[model samples]
Target: ARLLKQYQTHLKKQASYIVEGNAESKRALRQHNREQIKQHPEWFPAPLKASDRRWQALAENNHFLSSDHLHNITEVAIHRLEQQLGKPYVWGGTRPDKGFDCSGLVFYAYNKILEAKLPRTANEMYHYRRATIVANNDLRRGDLLFFHIHSR
Candidate 1:
């Protein structure tokens, strides 16, 4: 229960980060475009109808997953992962029948749980757009962590 609560909080923070980051990026882009147009009227001879259309499209797709919805999904995913605790680790495996590698375990647990597909490899997961870099002190249960391991 405590872990679920921590996951819920983490989901809320992540959602807010994505939404706020996108909004700030859009604002910055608009400001930059305005300045560019002001400096070079001939370069932007026509009104920015294309830019408006792109912004409108982005706005239409900006809906974030709700905290309660994600919380329930995370709870289920955690349970699923726990059930696989004693399984053997297999490279590139993603299902219980085949066992799992580290990233494969995560891929099985959360991929498509909320209609979002996770990348197959840890390196890809680390670079995924929605993946945030949380401080070690800020980590909580259900939070996915990535690390760099040098090969000997």
Candidate 2:
């Protein structure tokens, strides 16, 4: 939420001035991006592994990424989910303002962003074909990969 607030604030001000005013707000907007780097050290581009061709290609061709779009899709979802960290886990609840269950959290995060029509139940997801089959090792950012945790 802090990130979104800063982003909106910056956008509203950027066109109004050409000086450090927008620059300052831009810094604030980027604070979340910096925090994301801190939170995910492994994903951060570094010098040591720069020789790996796959990493090199991915870094070189972040073709769709914008400056503000620094985070992976999963990081964005994680950031949204982090806002609900202290809230009570309510069964069958659907919104952040109310509360959430496991599926509710998934629903709230991906519904509008992904334009996905996910079923309300957790297990029904596997029955749906909208979800692409991704191997564990092939998981990419923002993927809604699931795992079986226990017997019901």
Candidate 3:
């Protein structure tokens, strides 16, 4: 339970970082609404509403952006990955520019290029919701592939 809470907190921080470009700049549920109301008093709903309403308003105001941007983002991400193609593969190394493992390569590309905010471990990334389990024959772009190289 504690570990799950930790991951949830990390996920919230990552989302805040993505939205605000820095997690420290993100305001809490009430704070954001207060700012919005102060900025656009006529546009905001009446004050003293539920906290969830304030939180929802803040979330709805933020944009996830469009898929159109993703293609360009993905191309750029691939370019970064290609630059590391010739580097030596070390098991636990995270430095792709020098050398790193298979997992490290993906981690670097996502965090640097897209700010994808994936899990730190391969096992967690494999099971994460963003990585849908598809049949090998039905594979598509950006799909996370898994191979059973060894058994536990």
Candidate 4:
């Protein structure tokens, strides 16, 4: 327990540092653009949105959000599960290499690594969380998948 807490603390601190670095990177980029604007003020259109452009460019980098603590947690969970990749498929087993149904896998994965115990069943899991539905373009690693199994 103490070791787990220490690990979580270290992860949180690293995540904070990463986020701070990302922010600094963005600030630097914006400053660079502002310098460009200052140098060529008459060449570009009026009322520039340099800030927006810098955000869009920074957002294009996948690693940009890996600094987020939530994202880091998801990444760590996925990495841990990847270590059990060749496991057999049991009807409801949650143990690694022994197989697992969908819900069982999810439950075991989160509980074992993330320390989060999600409910069982696809429908239950689908509705259990308070996540907003995001477009495919907005999906990220570890995003939940939902389907209407019985619907048209």
lDDT of 3 by residue, 80-115 (tens): 677788899888767955798887888876665443
TM-score of each: 0.54, 0.48, 0.52, 0.52
Give candidate 2 misplaced runs (Cα > 4 Å). Answer: 1-73, 149-152
Clashing pairs in 1: none
Compared with the true structure, all predictions reach lDDT values of 0.66, 0.57, 0.58, 0.59
Please say which candidate is ahead in lDDT: 1 or 2.
1
Q: After superposition, how far is residue 45 of candidate 3 from its true place, in Å?
A: 27
Backbone clashes, each candidate = 0, 0, 0, 4
Q: What is the per-residue lDDT of model 1 for residues 79-105, given as tens digits with 9 covering 90 to 100?
A: 878989999989888889879999999
**Model 1 weakest lDDT span, ten residues long:** 57-66
For model 3, what is the C-alpha lDDT against the true structure?
0.58
Query: Which candidate achieves the best TM-score against the true structure?
Result: 1
Residue 44 error, candidate 3, Å: 24
Name the lDDT value of residue 54 in candidate 1.
55
What 10-residue stretch in candidate 4 is worst by lDDT?
58-67
